[model samples]
Target chain A: MQMDLVFVGWNHRVASLDLREKLSFTPERAREAMEGLFREKILTEGAVVSTCNRAEIYGLTDLDDSFEALASYFSRFHDVDGSVLRESALSGRGDVTVRHLFRVASGLDSMVLGEAQILGQIRDAHRRATEAGTARTVTHRLFQAALECGKKVRTRTALGTRPTSVPGIALSLVGRIFEEVADCRVLLLGAGETVELTARLLADDGVTRMSFCNRTQEKAAALAAEFGGTVVPWEERIPAFAAADVVLTATGATDPVIPGPEAKRALSKARRRGPLLVLDMAVPRDVDPAVEDVADVYRYDLDAFGELARANAAERQAEVPLAEAIVEESVEKFAAWLASLSMTEVVKQLRFKLEAIRRDELARSEPRLARLDPADREMVERLTEALLNKILHNPTVGLKHGDASQRLELAAAVRTLFKLDGEGRE
Target chain B: MASPSSPGLTNALLGVLALAAYALASVFYTAYLRHPRLKAGRLATGLAVLGAALNFSFLYARSLALKNVPYADLLGSMALFGFFLAGMNLVLEVRHHDRSLGPFLMPVSLLFLLLAFVLPAGGEKRPNLKGAIFAFHVTLNMLSYAAFAVAAALSGLYLVLGKKLKHRSKNVLAGPTARLPSLGYLERAARTSLGVGVVTLAAGLSMGFAWGYHVWRVDHPFWLLDAKIWGAGLTLLFYFVVLVRAHRGAAPVTTARLCIAGFVLVLLSYTAVNLFFSRIHSFT
Candidate 1:
C-alpha cells in the first residue's frame, strides 16, 4: 500500500561500453540478485532489464533511500566503486521512473531510435522477475501496461516506420522514388557485401527482377544465383543502365564505373519516360556526380544518402510528441491503478475482518446450528458468504469506479468507518 | 415520408443538413490527413455517408412530391449530382481501403450542394419529358459527371503527390500533401474513375442522341449548333483519348495531366455549357 517506484539505469547515451558491460546482469544472475534484494528489504518488487545497449533496474520501494540502495547494490554486486556508479548513472523517482521505462520499452530511447527489440527485452526481464517471485502486483502491472503502450505507439504512430540503417535507407529511397518496387527492375552493381545486403532487403520489399553487374562476373553470377537474378556481362554494364529502372552501385573500384556522360547518353538513347534512380553507395562513388544533372536521372552518392538517413531521423524525431502522448496516457493510467491499490488494500482488509466475524459468529452458535441436517448446514454457510459479498458489493464498486482523488476519500472513509486499520497505517 | 420533426425532412432543410455534413467532413478529413493520430478519418467517412444519405432523402422528397426521378430542374439536378459524387466516393474509398482522399474530394460535392441552395427549388421546373429513356439519359449523364469529378480530385492529388515524390520532399506532414496516396495508386485510381466516367458518358450520350432523335427533329436549323452538344462531344473525345493513353501505360505524370485536362473539359461541359449557351439543353 505504501509502495513507491524507483529506477536506476545507464544507457549508451550516458555510460561508456566498459561501464555498461561491467554493470550488466545475466538472466540467471538477475534472478539470484533480485531474491537477495527481497531479503535485504530495499524493494518490495523489482525487475532488471540488461541488454547490450542498456542496463536498467526497476523496482517498487517504500524506503526513502531505496534509490541510493539500488545504486549501492549495483556497485557492490558488480565490484565497482559506489561513487563511480553514482557519477555515471542517475536514478529516476515515481513518475520519472514510469516515463523512462515506457520510453525505453516503446523504443523512443533506443540507440537506434524506434528499434523494436527493447519491448521484448523488457518483457523478458519482467518474466524473469516474476519467475523469481520478486515481481508482485505493481511491477507486473507496470511492465504489462508499458508493453501495451509500446505496441500502441508502434501501431498508431509512424515513429518506427522510417528506416535508419544503410539498407533501410536504401529501401526508403527506393520507396520514395518508385511507387511500386514490385514492378521496378533493380540493377545491383558490384556483387559486394553491401550490394548483397541491399539486394536481400530490396528483394524482401518486393524487388523481383534483379540484374547484377560486377567486374568479376563470377561474383556477380553467384549473387544473382542467390537472389534469383541474372548477371549482365561487365562489358554490358553501361548498356544495362538503359534497361534498369533503379541502379544501385557499391563497387570497390577506385574510379567511377558508370560515368555521368555515358549514363546520360545511354539513358537519352533509350528515351526512358520515367525516372532513373541511381544510388551510388561506394566510398569513392561508383556513379559520377554529374549523372544527377541529366534530365529524369536522379542520383545520390554515399554522402547524399547519409543526408537522407539524417533527414529520416529528423522525421522520426518529429513523431516524438505523438509517441510521448501515448506514453503520457499510459503513465496516468498506471498512476490511477497504483492509487487504487490503496483502496484495494482497504477492501481486502475489510473482507478479511468480515470473514473473521462470520466464522466467529458461526462458531459461537455452533451447538444451535449443529441440529440442522448436513445439507442445511452447508446452505447456511453459503448463505452467510453470499450475504457478506452482497454487503461488500456497492462500497467496492464505489471505491473502484470514481476518480483517483475521490476514491482516495472513499478509501479513507472506509478505513475509518470499518475501524480495521487506522490512519496510523498511512 | 419523413416527418417534419426529422432534421432533414424538408427539402430546404435537407440541403442545409447535407451541406453542413459535407463541410464538417471536409474539416475532419483534412485534420485526419495532417495529423493521422487525431483519428478523425472514420468520423469523416461517416459524415460524408450521412451527407449522401441526406442528399438521397432530398431527392426522394422531390420524387415523392412530383413522382419523377427528381432531375427535371436545375436545383434537383445539382442535388442529385452532389449525391452521386458522395455515393461514388464512398464506394471508391471503401474499395481502395484508403480514406485519405475524402478531404480532397468532398468539397466538389459541397460546392454543388451550395449551388443547389442558391438556385430555385425543384418545384420551379417540373418534368418536361417523362419517359424511362429520358430519365436514364439524364441520370447517366449526372452519374458520369460525378465520376469525372472524382477523377478530377484524384488526378489533382496525383499531380501534387507525384511532384512531391519526384522532388523527394521530406516534408510529408506539411500542408495538404500529407496522407496523399502513392503516385501509382493515385494514377491507377484516377484512371479507374476516368474509365467509369467514360463508359457512363458513352452510354448516356448515346441514350441522349437516340432519345433526341425521336424528341427533336433532326432537320432543325440549330440542332447541331447547341453549345452543350458540342461541349459534350468535345469532352467525350478528349477523355476517351486520355483513357486510351492511360490504358496503354503512359508515363504516370502525363496520364495525370491528361486526366486533369479531361476534367477541365468536363467542368466546362457541365457548367458553362449547361448553364449558359446551350440552345437545346438547360441542365445544371
Candidate 2:
C-alpha cells in the first residue's frame, strides 16, 4: 500500500476559542505526546499544531488501517469523548491534505478572514515537530513550502495591512482624526486585556495622557501603573468627559453609562472648547448613540467599527489573486520534489535488469565463443555492453517523465519484470 | 424643426405608463403601511418592482428612440427619479428580506412619476459646452440621489427599528427589519453618495461658470447666484460635515438621521430650481 499524508483536527471555523483551548496541547506536551505515539508504533510520523484558535494533527502513515488507532489516541490525549472528537475533527488524505495545509498557511481558513498570525503559528508547529524528531522528509518539505507561500502572499498583497479586530479598527480611525497622538488624552472605560492592548497601542502612537476608569479603581490603578497612566474614579467619569479628547468605553454595563442628555450637555461644554472623539466599543454600548446629534461630538460603536473594518478588509481583498498565484507556484514545486523520491528504487531495478540480461546472454553464448581467440572474446563483451545500454535507454527515459502515480506503477513493474521481490532472483 | 423620427411617441407613452403604474403601486404600498401584513407587504413589493421594471423599460425605449441619453429633460429626469426610488426599494427588500420600506419608497416614486407626466417636454435642445457636460453631471447627480434615497429610507427604518429594539426589547424585528444593516452601512452609503454628488455638482457648477464666462465675460459668475447651484452647494456642505463626523465614527443611527436630512436638502435643491427659479438646468 502507498504511504499517504493526512491531516486531522478542528480549527476556528468549526470550533470556538473555548473549545479549541480545551483541545490544545502546549508545545512541550505536544512533543512528549508525539514521541509517545511513535513509541507506541501508532504512527510512523506525526506533528501537532496547537494554537489559541485550533489544534491540528498532521501525519504520514504507511499503514492505512492506523487511522482509527490515531483517532483513539487523539481522543485519549485531549481527554475528550471519542464521538465529540470525531465530529469536530477534519481528516484529509493525499492531495486534499496538501491543499488544506496550503490554504491554512495562507490564512484563507482563518477566523478573522485574512489574518497573518496563522502563518507564524504554522511555523511554530513545524519547529516543534522537528524538535520532536517526528517530522519526516515529506512533512518537512510540505511545511517549508507552505511557510514560503505564506510569506510571499503577505509581501505581495495588502492582506496584512487591513484591520479585522474592533480595537484595531478604532485605532485606524484615531490615526485618521489626530495628526499626532502626542497631545491626545485618551480615557479608557474598562481595564480588561482588550482595553490594555488598545491603551498600549495608543501609547505606542505617542498618546501622553491615558486614564483607566473601571468599576474597581484598584484594578484600574494596577493597570494604569503598569502602562504609566493614571486611574480615574468611576463616579467622576461623567464630569471628566471634557478632559478626554478620545473617550473609549468598553465597560460591562448593560445600561448606557453616558446617557444622551449628559452627553449633549458635555458636548455643549466641549464645543465651547474643542471636538471630543467617543468610541463606544462595548457590545451593548456604554454611550447613547443620540449623543452624535450634538455638534462637534463624534461617536462610534462596535457595529460602526465593524463596517470600517470590513471596508478596509475589502480593500485588502483586492490583492487576493496575487496571493493565490504565489501559493499555486509553491504547490507545484512541492509536488515535483515529492514525485522525485521514488527515483532511487527505479535506478537500482534498472541496473539489476541490465546485469541479469548480460549474465543470461553470456551463458547462452559460452558454447559458441569457446573456439574464439581472447581478443575476439573481448570484442563480444563490448558488443554485449552496447546491447544492454540500448535496451535500458527507453526505460530510463520513461522513468524520468513519470509523476508520483506513474512512478509507483513503474517501480512495481520494474520489481515484477526483474523478479526482484523478497525471493531476490535478479 | 424637430426631427420626424424623434422620441416623441415613446417618451409620451412611457411617461403615461410609468405614471399609471407608479400610482397603482403607491396605493398597494399605502395599503401595506396601514395593514402591515406579510402577504400585503409582499404584494406591495411585487407591485413596486413591476412599476420599476416598466420605468426601466420606458427609459430603455426612450434612450433608443431619442438616439441620445434617455434622461435628458425634466420629464425624463423625473421618470429616472421614480426608477431610482423603486430600484432602491427593490434592493432593500431583497437585502433585508423585508418589505416594510415599500410604504415610504413607493409614494416618493409615484410622486416623481406623476410630476414627470405634467412637466413640459419638447424644449429646444440647447447646444453648448454647459449643455454637453449637463447630461453627465445630472446623470451622476440622479444616481447619487438614488443612493441617498435608499440611505434615507434605511435611516427612517433604523429609527423605527432602534425604537422597537429599545422599548419592546423584542428581537423579532431584529432578524428582518431591525437587521437592517448596522447604522454604519447606511451612513457609508450616504457618505459615498454625497461624495459622488459633491464631485458631480462641482463639475456641473464649474462647467456652467465657464460657459457663463464665455457668453457674458463678467467678473461676477452668474452661476454663483443661481439658486440650483446655491442649494446644491448647501446640500454639499451639509453632507461634508456628515462625512467628517462619520469619519470620526459618529453614532450610525444619528448619522443615518443626518443622511435623511441631507436627502431632504437634495430634494429641495432639485425642486427649488424647477419650481422657484429659471437657471441653467431649468428644462422649461
Candidate 3:
C-alpha cells in the first residue's frame, strides 16, 4: 500500500493576517472537520493544527485525489472562493509535506523563528486527532516524531533561548539575575501596557508577591486586580521598592521617579540579602542611572534590554542551520520508519513461507525418524528447526535493513524460489 | 581451570578496554557541549559507567596478580583515581540532573588513564603493609583526592561563567552557556565536594598516623616530617579553609579560587613529593 502523507495549510508568511484569521478554526471545529474527512475516506488518518497565525491539516491518504478533495472541503466548509483559497494557501505531498511538518513542529516555520508556542499547538492538534479517532499508525508516528524533533531542536540548539519580544527580554534578564523567580516580589511602577505585559510575563515566571504603583491610583488598582495582586500607593512606593526583589519601571514621567539617593537609602533600610534586579523600561528613564552605583543592585535600561534582545536574536538566528539539520535528520528517520513498516510486512510473509516449507518437510520425514527413540525423533525435529532458522536469518536481516527497491526485488525472488504466492502461502 | 592468558595480560587488556571506553565518553561529552542533547548525555554517561566498571575490574585483576591491594603502586593508584573521578561524576550527574560538567570533567579522567598507561604496572617490591588501617588510609585518601578533583573542575567552571557574566559577553547565555547549570548550582556542588574532601582527608590522615604508629613504633614516627605528610596536611587544611569560607558566605569566585588552590596543593602532594623527594611513604 502506498501511504501519501500531505499537509494543506496557510500560515502567517503565505497568507494575509485577515485571511489567516478567516481560515482559523476552533479546536472543536477543527476536530469535527478532521473526523469528517476521515469519515469520508478523503484522509485515512488526519490531524488539524489550527492557531491564530496558521491552520493546517496533516493527513495520510492512499488516493491520488486526496489533496484536491481536502482543498475543496476546506473552501466549502469555510465558504471561501476556491480560487482565492488556492491563491492564499499551499499544499504539499510526500516528503515535502513531511519536511514542512517537521519544520513547523521545530518552530522554524513560526511567525517568530524558534517560537516555543507552535510545539504546544502541534501537540494539542495530535491530542485532538487522537481523541477524534482520526489518527493511526503513520500519522501518529509522524506527529510523535515531529514532537520529538521539536524538543530536540529546542534543547539541543540555542534556538529558543533568545527572547524575541520585549516581555521575553525582561524574563530572560530576570532569569540571568536570579536562579529562581518563585521567591521574588515584583514591584510594577506603572499601569501602562508595557508594565502590564511585563507583569504577566513575571507572573508566568512564578513571581507571586506582586504590587503595582501608578500616578493614577485607579489604574494601578485595575492592573493589580487583573493579576490578583494589590495596589501600592505613590507615598508607600519607597517601602514597597525596598521590599521588592525585582522592580520594573515603565512610566510616562519625564523626570526620574526613583532617584539614586532615595534608592540607596531605601536599600540600606531594607538590608536585603540578595541582589535587586531593576528593569527601567521607560523611555525618559524612570529609575536614575546613578542607582547602578548602589551595592547589590543590577540595573538595565531600555537600551540595555534592546541590546540583549538583538544579541540573543542574532545568536538564535545563527542556530537556525543546526535546527534545520535536526529537522532534516528527523524527516529522514521518519521516512526510514515508514519504509521499515513495509519491510516488516515483507518479512512476515517471508517467515510464513519458510515456516510452511519447514512444516511440510517435517511431516514427510517424521515417520522414518520416528522409528528411533522418541528422544531421537525430537532431536531430529530440533535439528531441522535450527537449520531453518539459520537458513532464514541472513535474508531476513538483509530485508529488514534493505532499501525499498532492494526489499521488493529480494521479496519477489524469495517467493518465486519457494513457488509461493505473493502472499507467501502455498 | 584453564586461562587464556596470564593475569597480567588480562589486567592490561582490561585497562585498554577502559581507556577506550573513557575516550569514547569524552568524545560524546565534548560533542554534547556544542550540542546539548539528552541522547548525547545519556550515551556519555553510559560509556563513563562502562569505563568505571572496566577500570574496577582492571584494579581487581592487578591485585590478584600481585597478591596485594593495588594501592601500593603509582599506576594502580592512578587507575583508582580515574575510576573514582568517573564514578563521582556519574553520581553527581544523577543527583543534580546536570550534564554540562561532563565535557570539562572527562578530560581529567582521560588524563589519569593516560598516566596509568606510562607508569609501571606494579610498585616497588616492598613488603605488603599489614593491617586494615593501612588499606583504609590509602582508600580514603584516594577518595578524597577524587572529591577535590571534582571540586576544582566545578570551581574552574564557576570562574569561566563568572567572567562571562561580569563582562556581559555577547552570546553569553547561548550555546554552552545555555547548557551550564546556574552558578548557584555549581557553587553548591563545589561546596559539597569540598566538605566531603575535607572530612575524608582528615580521617585518612588520622588513619595513616595510627597505621604508622603500629607499623614503625611510636618512637620511629619520622614519616610525620616527610614531604608527603606535610603536603597532605597542607592540602587538607587548604580545603578546610575553603569549607569555612563557604560557610561564611564568601563570594562564589573567592570560594572557587580557594578550591582551585586546594587542588594545586593536592597535586603537589600526590605527584611532586612522590617523584622528587625521598620519604618513608615513597612506596609508589
- Tens-place lDDT digits, model 1, residues A308-330: 67776887888899999999999
For residues A118-155, write the lDDT of model 2, one tens digit per residue.
Answer: 99899989998888787866667778888888887776
* Candidate with the greatest DockQ versus the true structure: 1
The C-alpha TM-scores of every prediction are: 0.78, 0.48, 0.69
Comparing 1 with 3 on DockQ, the higher-scoring candidate is 1
Choose 1 or 2, whichever is better by lDDT: 1
Instruction: Please report, as a residue range, the 10-residue window in candidate 3 chain A with the lowest summed lDDT.
Output: A400-409
Expressed as tens digits, the lDDT of each residue in B1-284 for candidate 2 is 11222367765666567667767777776665554455666667777777888888887887777666666676677778889878877876787575656767788888887777765465477544235555566666676677667667767765654454333232312124322443334444455655655565566556555556665455435646767767766776787787678666675566778888888888888876656684664654
| Better-scoring candidate (lDDT), 1 or 3 | 3
Model 3 interface root-mean-square deviation = 3.2
Off by over 4 Å in 3: A1-10, A18-50, A55-106, A122-163, A169-191, A205-426, B1-17, B37-40, B65-68, B73-76, B116-129, B212-230, B273-284
Per-residue lDDT tens digits for candidate 3, residues A136-239, read 66778889999999999998887987887778877775676566777678899989989988888888877888899999999999989888888999988877
lDDT of each: 0.79, 0.70, 0.80
Which number leads on lDDT?
3
Model 3 error, position B232 (Å): 3.6
